[model samples]
Target: MKSVTILLYDGFSNMVLSCLLEPLRAVRDQSQSALHWHIVTPHDGPARSSSGLNIAPDLACKDVIKSDLLMVVSGYGYRQHAKPENLRPLRLLTRQAASIVAADTGSWLLASAGLLDDQTATIHWGVISDFTEEFPKVRPSYERFVKHPRISTCGGASTALELMLAMISEQFGPADAFIASTMFLHDAAQQQSTGRGPNRLEGKGTAQLRQIVNRMVETIETPLSLEELAQQSGLTRRTLDRLFQAELAMSPGRYYQLMRLTHARELSTSTDYDLREIALRCGYADASALGKAFRKAFGHPIRKSRGSRPH
Candidate 1:
């Protein structure tokens, strides 16, 4: 059986841990004896997560080398907890493992050990800049997740699950991945096909409405006005507005504006761009306008929101 070791510690995100494990469990349940998982920690003790959930590790870090895959799961205090002392052993373990994956902030641990030196890596979008600043040797991509030569890094909880699903697809087949999605109650077609993460086009609407949402997402960095959006959709302004409200429970203009803000938030946290640059890229006239909208929507200023260290 293929063995996967998930590294856990204090302040780990329980949701991310679940996302990575569920698909793998599905793989095992479907294929019978195809895969197995083991949870590891610095010490075999109760590891507390940032969300106040604690998990017991099955083994210590020193014993993690026996696994076929090693995935380090991390959260807010990762840098402090996932330090050189703790990572060196895991880094050594990497030599014997089939693949090493980092869930969310755990990418930092991999980068810290020089594992991502020449590999494409990603982490939680909120900490991307700090990660880049700290590890200039690594290439940072805007993808939700990226799998390199021997390393895989994911952006957030959602992408963490995608990485797992992609792994299942690679190991078993596309069919297995699709089956796992159905068991997980996710859109299998959307999960594997759409490059965008899930829920980007979630609304009970017609095909034309889905196309309109797609177009809006495409133009997120350089948003179109309501009139232009409707024109592109081959619908009148009044009709488009009515459809958006009826289907999405929001006006077209509001949806478009929120799309821009979402793009701005992702860009702000995932890239080295400043507020001004992000604003320009997200179709805002200036930083101040973007800041106002961002604060109003997220209940925090754009500057403060970047590099979210988890509550």
Candidate 2:
């Protein structure tokens, strides 16, 4: 079981807090690994967010005994919140927690406490120059997030969600993380790469592309070759490839392979089927064949990714 503690402060960003909590909510619902969380403030009082929403603490920060993960989430007014009274408990809890994560200006608080002296961390980009000037010892990156073994930091609200998803995938396996992403319809990887929201592609030009995706979804168990897909869709192979690349951003063959692998992963996690059976059902030749592709896609073998079906 993983016990998570959120150390929230006044003037926090509600969106950043939600981004930190929502992925944990999804994993607690879908993960085989047990997870629990509690929210707390400096003195067990209500804290107001930047958007004027108030959150009452479940406990005080000093009351915390230990935590598997400690999340420090602050936004505006972080400078004022860096007093020794607040930083003292934060330093203690950070030392005891298995991992320490900070969002937005949260890294400012940690660095102020001397908790991140030797860590390479990222903070809200707007404050990079000030942060570097303030904390000469801590290396600051301008990336969306930085994931270190013991300490990690995210730059903003959306990156908070991205960091949580990666942590979820690490602790509960990629299958659970993928399932959690479905719950929110969040595509963090694509969003990061494209610097835009998910492309719905629900336009007149995408009718055929949508049909092709639907076909891929329907044929997960018996994937069709690119030639077969083209013939069935009344498209030449070149046209089929163009349609997928222009909309879905991958070739027909690559999409079909991914489709089959996803189903294979679902079965591995949610059912009692052995690897050989799952491979055959997902259109692979055997366990070895599926293992090769699965490792490539998820960076883990199917056996290691298996877990009790989430209740």
Candidate 3:
């Protein structure tokens, strides 16, 4: 998106704002998009962070012309900031913004403005009980973040980063998101859908499941047998199968294949490895076998998707 308006209020989280902006900065640097943003406060002057940092605004909220994306960020005392003067401008901005994001306590302001009526949303976990009691019509999800086409809400910095990456993936492509995710050293162990079908292996779940997935990642070049996988995780095949199916909605075999293919895709995009080498690295016996599986899943040969890129 070209134009972004970040609406801040007093007592916002400095770290939350950093998490929101840093990923966008990374996307701007990594992608071909001409993304830019400006900060705004409800009235004027500056917004103070919970950590005692003062950030002067670029413009008043009422003066915002338009925004491709509007981000509402706040922390303590967000309810008091939802007075008529602020709500009036927030409602107007929401109607104009193509997409909306509420990070940390900002969802409270959006809910107060009646913007979250009848929508499934989430807020920082600490305030979720109060949020539920305050907004009876809104359906609340305990997800780290709930992202839809028009609006999204998240709890903390890590979830905010995932939300930004999801938006980047939706707008640009997964490759850019992947680069940023890895570059940030984001654990990415989120449990939610993320609006993108996340690799559950790289996400949050039970310790045993994580143990198996870690083994899978480590054995990409020489995939472990299901028997070996189960043994390493200290479980039987049936138990492992049940766990993957129940949690990730897939059989262990299928999840392992997805892991291999996803790893293969990443390697193809980020490196100059030949198909045969990439195939071998991803645990495929040879180029032909890898080609068959890769095409079946991704709808194209790896060579074609690789294309010409920087080494």
Candidate 4:
């Protein structure tokens, strides 16, 4: 039997919490792993999310028993909750638990407790610069997740799901992990699969198509022309067009344009970069060109996407 303990804080993301728990529960249901979890808080009672969803904890932090894995979950307003008194239990767990995982901004709390010194870690990208500035001893990564020997960190809910799935594969087997992923409608091949399975895009299209897409993703800041992309994929322009049309229902040019615009939208929402800077990063000649393309693809002005993000 593997035991897991989750320390929840007020204003934690309910979605992130569920992403970690649901897959493990599904694995337990299908296999004989006997995976169990206990939710703990600084005080024994309900912890509410920013959206008002409430979760009841099974134990107070001071009363938590040792577990194979201890995960700290934090979201908005994490700084206010990461006081010394509230972190005492976590500091104690560092010596007791087998491994510690930080989810979302929980990395900030762990670093505050000096648990991540000299350890490679990652927090949500939106706060990564702040995390690095505050904790210089902790090596911060731009990856979606980082897994060290005794400590791990994840950037957000989706990466947390990936981390848990990888842990499940290590404990059980790849087959069991695949089953759990399928239950969640997640295609394991698209991710770093735990088991030796076919990639999600393996049979969906030719290898050339996958290669072309990867190239586009890598060069988002300086996009390649359609002819250049075709040459790199070792295919003619016509074949590239045919393959993309058959596989993605769009031309290679359209798909590439959409990819760049999608990246532009992410930058707009997640960072404070101005339109001119974002446009240059996305390979646009100017802000006007970027705005025209963004509106065409997403049906809204770029400013609207920036304004819609939570303040």
| Top-TM-score structure, candidate number | 2
lDDT of 4 by residue, 174-282 (tens): 5445445544432323242444445544223455565677778778889999999999888999999999889655688877786677567768878999999999999
Model 3 lDDT, residue 160, Cα? 84
Per-residue lDDT tens digits for candidate 1, residues 254-298, read 767766775676676578888899999988889999999977665
- Candidate 3 lDDT: 0.78
| lDDT (CA) per prediction | 0.74, 0.78, 0.78, 0.78
- Candidate 1: list runs displaced more than 4 Å: 184-311
Whichever of 1 and 2 has more lDDT, that candidate is 2
**Model 2: lowest-lDDT 10 consecutive positions:** 184-193
**Model 2, span 1-311: residue lDDT tens:** 28999988899999898888887876664443468889988657898999899999887777789999999998898988997776776777887799989999999999999888988999998898999999999998988899998889998877887788788778876555655554343242334235565555312125466566666666777778889989999999999988877854456676577667767777887888999999999998899999999877666677765754555
Tell me the lDDT of model 2 at 143: 85
User: Model 2: runs farther than 4 Å from truth?
Assistant: 186-311
Number of colliding residue pairs in each model: 0, 0, 0, 0
Residue-level lDDT tens digits of model 3 in 1-311: 88999988788998889878887876665443578999988767888889888999887777788899999998888878876676876787888799999999888889998889999999999999999999998899999899988889998777887788878777766545544554343243322224333554334365566556667767889998999889888889999889988865568887788678767766777897888998999999998899999777655577765663455
lDDT for residue 206 in candidate 1, whole number 0-100: 55
Q: Evaluate model 1: give its lDDT.
A: 0.74
- How should the candidates be ordered by TM-score, best one leading? 2, 3, 4, 1
